[model samples]
Target: MIDFLNSIDTQLFLFLNGLHNAFFDPIMYWLSDKWIWVPMYVFMAYLIVKHYKMKGILIILTVGVVIALCDQTASHLIKHAVMRLRPSHEPSLVGLIHLSKAGPGGMYGFVSSHAANAFGLATFLYFVLDGRLRILKYWLFIWAILVSYSRIYNGVHYPGDVIVAAIIGTLIGWGMSKLFLYIENRRLKNK
Candidate 1:
């Protein structure tokens, strides 16, 4: 079962990577600049604040911090413990596509942080926000999916890496939302 899943994941990764390179890669590369992330972070923060007020803002921020921490920790563990080489660095996978230049330390690639972080934020926001922001939710999902695809398109991570990271991120988001709601209700009862 695991091998079957892995095979499917690899094929999906290749398909998505090709699609990303053909369409979304250039746009994401332009937008993946640090400054762009900063503004996006601020905008997401603003949305949380506007929708949920102070308590919601705090909860969202806490979730964001936790997600970031989880992303980093998981990436570190997989990179160090697994010692998996990136697809781009693998001679077998060479000529698959144009790969982005490697960063310092020859970082190991397994779980993708981009996938984790983007899906983490998207899932958390979708869970926390009430009412029918259906369009926004769709867009968020799209964004998360696209970001995950970027990792493979850049040849920095395997399909398994992004898939597991996405699952982890989604679970974290959902769990945090429930926790936040419970805390809020308890506080209200105490008031």
Candidate 2:
């Protein structure tokens, strides 16, 4: 079953990586670049501050926790445990894979930190905002999807890697959001 799933993952990776073109190569590279999203990060900070005011600090802290958890889990724990080679680094996929200038990232690519972090933030915000700013919350998901897809497009991650990372991220996000809410409610009650 594992071999069968790996075969499908390879095929899917090839299909998605093959879709790259001159027009989208740079765009995908940009999307996959972590530093390129600083403006969006700043905007998120502004929104949290604007909406939650003093409590925005707490929200921001929770966001940090979510990202830290996602990054460590995806990059350190799972990747090391699985030790699966990225498509770019896979000998069988040497000629078949398409990589941006960024090249193959770290050796293992079982779960993508980029996808985890993006989806983690998106899921957390979606729940935190709840009914208040419906459009913004929905847009957060679109952003997460695009970021996750970009990992596959850039050839560093298989679709399965991104999918699993997204699931893990969503779960972590949900858990953190629940914890944040519980703490917030308790603080209010005490006040």
Candidate 3:
């Protein structure tokens, strides 16, 4: 079963990676780049402050915490444990993958930290901002999915790696959101 799934993953990776062109390459790279999202982060902070006032600062801080957890767990724990070779580094995929990296990626690519962090922030924001901004719930997931797709297009990770990271990241984000809410409710009760 694992072999079959891996086979499918490679085939899908090739198909998706094959579709990239010069025009879209830079865009995907930018989407996957962490620094490029600074504006988005600032905007998110503004949104939280606008809606929740002083308490909104807490949500912004929690987002950072959530992303840190997702990134560290995915990169340090899961990827090292799995040790799956990146498509760009896989011997079998030589001459087939479109290597788009500025530098060689890590040896293993089991769980993509990029996907984990992006989805983690998205899911956490969706939960914390629940009902306040209905549109953002869908937007956040779509943004996360786009960023995950960029990992496959960048040739550093397979679709399976991104998907697995997204699931784990979402779970982590959900757990954090619940924990935050529970503490908040308890504090309000005490007050």
Candidate 4:
């Protein structure tokens, strides 16, 4: 069953990764790059400060911690333990996969740190600012999904890796957000 699933995974990966084109290649590569998203991060910081005001500092702090936790859990604990080779690095996929100048990333790719960090930030932001900004919440999730898909497009991660990482990241984000809110609320009442 596992082999069957893995075979299907590889096939799906081929289809998705195969859909690339010259014009979109650079876009996907840029989307997968962390440094390219600095403006977006700055915008998110602006929104946090604008919306939460005094609490924004604490929220931003928690967000950094949440992202760190997600990255560590996915990269160190999960990916290392699973030790799955990235499609670009797989021997069978040597010629079968398309790799960009961005490269295959780390040797293991079971759980994508990119996907985890994206989803963690999206989910955390959603929890903290959902009702406050109705439509933007949807956009946040869309951004997270795109970030996950970019990993597959980059050939550094399989779809399953992104999916599992998103799920794990969601849980981590939700838990951390809830804990922070709980503490914040308690502090407010005590004051």
Candidate 5:
């Protein structure tokens, strides 16, 4: 069963890789890094503040910090400890797709920071702001899924890495939301 599941994952990864190469080659090369993501985060923070006021601003900031910590901890420490090579970096998987420049980075691929960060923020915001921003919750999840797929498409992370990162990110997001909600409710009661 595990082998079968792995095979499906490999096929899914390859399909996404092919799609990216076919349709988003320029975007992948140009807009797939911190430059794009940081501005996005800034915009998201702005929107959160605009909509939710001061409380929303504080929650967004907290979630941003948590996402950054989770992304870096998984990408740097756990990934290095695991030391799983990317498909492009592996001899066996070469020629399956066009490989991107390595860029300045470490040689680890157990979990994709891109996937974790995007999905973590998405999930966190989804739960926290769902009541007020019902439509946005769906868009946020779609955005997270696409970001996760982009990692595989860019040939920097395997299917396993993306999956694990997503799961870990979701869990962290959900946990943080619950924690914050509990604290906020307690404060409300006190008030």
Candidate 6:
């Protein structure tokens, strides 16, 4: 079953990666670049601070924790355990991948850290902001999806890698959001 699924994952990765062109090459490369999202992160921080004022500091800290958890779990824990070579690094895929200038990335790529981090942030913001910023709930996921897809387009990860990372990230984000809400309710009740 695992092998079967891996075969499909490889096919899907090729299909998605093959769709790339000159115009989107740079765009997707930048999209996958961690440094490129600094302004977005800053804007998100601004929103959190604006909405919660001083209390937003705690929320921002929690957001940091979310990203940390997602990144570490995907990049270190799971990748080391699974030891799945990235499509770009796979010997069988030589001369077939469309890697960006970012190079092949680290050795293993079972779960994409980029996907995990992006989805973690997006899911957390969606739950926390919800009605506070209705549009955010929708657009944040779009941003996450675009970022996740860019990994495959850049040929560093398989679709399976991104998919599992998204699931891991979403669960982590949802769990953290609930924990935050519970703590908030407890604090409010004490006051």
Assess candidate 4 and give its lDDT.
Answer: 0.88
Residue pairs in clash, model 6: none
Off by more than 4 A, model 5: 1-12, 20-22, 101-105
State every prediction's TM-score relative to the real structure.
0.80, 0.97, 0.95, 0.96, 0.85, 0.97
Q: Model-by-model lDDT, in order?
A: 0.69, 0.90, 0.89, 0.88, 0.75, 0.91
Q: Give the clashing residue pairs of candidate 2, or none.
A: none
TM-score of 2: 0.97
Q: Candidate 4, after superposition: displacement of residue 27 in Å?
A: 0.6
Where model 1 places Cα greater than 4 Å from the true spot, the runs are 1-25, 31-34, 101-106, 132-134
Residue 146's lDDT in candidate 2: 92
Instruction: Give stretches of model 4 more than 4 Å off.
Output: none
RMSD of 5: 2.6
Could you arrange the candidates by TM-score from highest to lowest? 6, 2, 4, 3, 5, 1
lDDT of 5: 0.75
Error of 1 at 58 (Å): 1.1
lDDT for model 1, please. Answer: 0.69
Q: Candidate 4, 3: how far from true, in Å?
A: 1.0
Off by over 4 Å in 3: 101-103
lDDT of 4 by residue, 71-107 (tens): 9999999988999999988999988777777987889
RMSD of 6: 0.9
Candidate 2 lDDT at 115 equals 93
Better of 1 and 2 by TM-score: 2
lDDT of 1 by residue, 35-139 (tens): 556776677667767766887668666766757765775677666787766666766656665555432115576677677777777787787666645566667
